[model samples]
Target: MARIIHALSEIAQDYDALFCDLWGCVHDGVRALPEAVAALQDYRANGGSVVLVTNAPRQRASVQRQIEELGVPADAWDSIATSGDAARAALFTGAVGRKVWFVGQPHDEVFFEPMKLIEDPVAIERVALDEAEGIVCCGPFDPHAHPDEMRPQLEAAKARGLPLLCANPDVVVDRGESREWCAGALADLYEHMGGRSLYFGKPHAPIYDLARRRLTALEKDIPDARILCVGDGIATDVKGALGEDLDSIFIAGGLAAAETKTEKDPDPDALHAYLQREKIAPTYAMGKLR
Candidate 1:
């Protein structure tokens, strides 16, 4: 069973670096979590390095700006690595088709910038599914639309046997006090419909490998055992850490808070049952990252 702690201070000395999740662990969709920010600051103040690892569909610069706007202190982390960064790298390898059907928010158009640098650039065309060679999905084309409403397009793409490149693999994230669907949810649907979807984020090695590289660049010769991943999503964060052989700290008050906690404290029995059901074992479980 994972130890339940109130603050990261209790185990801060155990790790040399932290690959912290930005969305639910550091802040909700709307604002920064003061205690979470303080925990990172405290960790860094003690000579450990912190790298903000996110599955955000936007690039690092865009994510940095959003975090700053949300009041995340610049000193809280030493570097940032995103799934978008890894996805761009994968896109450059020329395995995916040149002409792609882009599906995501308009702001996520930033993902296509790197394609312009390649000799034979991948052209992003928002065309009918039949006209496209491949599909690149970042997130919901319409965040307010339900999954059922988005199925017809996915069905059409599936019929064409187009490969989907998913930038962010999170199914749902906590936005303030509410939960919202993400690209992973759509990807799940696509797969259920016999469509192939390629994920570039957590629970997959690409993003974790990128985060480790960023952390190593900041702190020379850091080993995987010395790095601790902290996040709220079990499938993404905890499973990702396990995949990379790194220890993980599960934040119960974030995405899984509704099922894992009673009031503000973790309900031990419920938390245990949930973790057991999910078949994941985090090194530690805390009410919050604080």
Candidate 2:
């Protein structure tokens, strides 16, 4: 609990490349943070390569389209890597031919576009279970009006002893001005009921490996010594960076800001303690990316 904030520009000198996080770090869901967006612009202008890594369960192309709509410069980064792409890859190689019962939003079905989609509703149709070789949990739901909304469905999947594939395993996300439960909630509940979930997104090696591949495809060797990762969530952003052996700068102004009092500097003491609880040790910590 040091309660220390590092100057962004000052640390910019130490890293040649930066892996930035979306959602909480750059935007609160509705609009993009002017300062955070500016920071990436500044970093890139300084000849540093930036790769925007996100746990969004959509393809990189779709995420990029959304980002461009948010006023973020498309040229700000050298590349973009998304969890959806990784999930699709898993469906092709790792879980090939597995009959998947996806429990998520209709748009998220794009992630399972590669899989042989079984559209029968898991909640209403019992026969869907008979056809399912595995379960792909995407989002909990748009508005989680009730916990049992997905509980019965999750319970059913668990009882069937079907392996779960969580495309976007983020428990929660800052959607506009509110925090809503994501796909991870269902995945967690399934696992609690003795079900296994293979996460294909952030905080996992497959996602990072995909991002690394994108970086290498640029035809320029990344100077590993000068690379850095900036993100919000400890489970995905920070943890993903650590898993990839990259120095990470945790931006606590997003989802974790709720655990603090002030939005500007958020209680560093409490944040440090929270990180410790999550077993995450970032190289640098900041209240916001800017």
What residue pairs are clashing in model 2? 16-226
What lDDT is reached at residue 207 by model 1?
88
Model 2 alpha-carbon miss at residue 220, Å = 2.6
- For model 2, how does the per-residue alpha-carbon lDDT over 1-290 read when each residue is reduced to its tens digit? 42346557878888877778888877777778888888888888888888888888888878888888887776677888887777776665545235676667777766745434333323221126558877766676564544357777777777777877777878888787777887777777778878888887778888777777887887757766677888888888878778878888878777787664437776766876787788778887788888
User: Least accurate stretch of 10 residues (summed lDDT) in model 2?
Assistant: 118-127
Model 1 misplaced stretches (Cα beyond 4 Å): 115-126
Per-candidate TM-score against the hidden true structure: 0.95, 0.88
Global Cα RMSD, each model: 1.8, 4.4
Q: For model 1, how does the per-residue alpha-carbon lDDT over 119-202 read when each residue is reduced to its tens digit?
A: 765444556667888888888887667767778888888888889888999999878867788888888989998999998899
Local error of candidate 2 at residue 64 (angstroms): 0.9
Segments of candidate 2 deviating more than 4 angstroms: 1-3, 94-96, 114-127, 146-148
Q: Which candidate number maximizes TM-score? A: 1
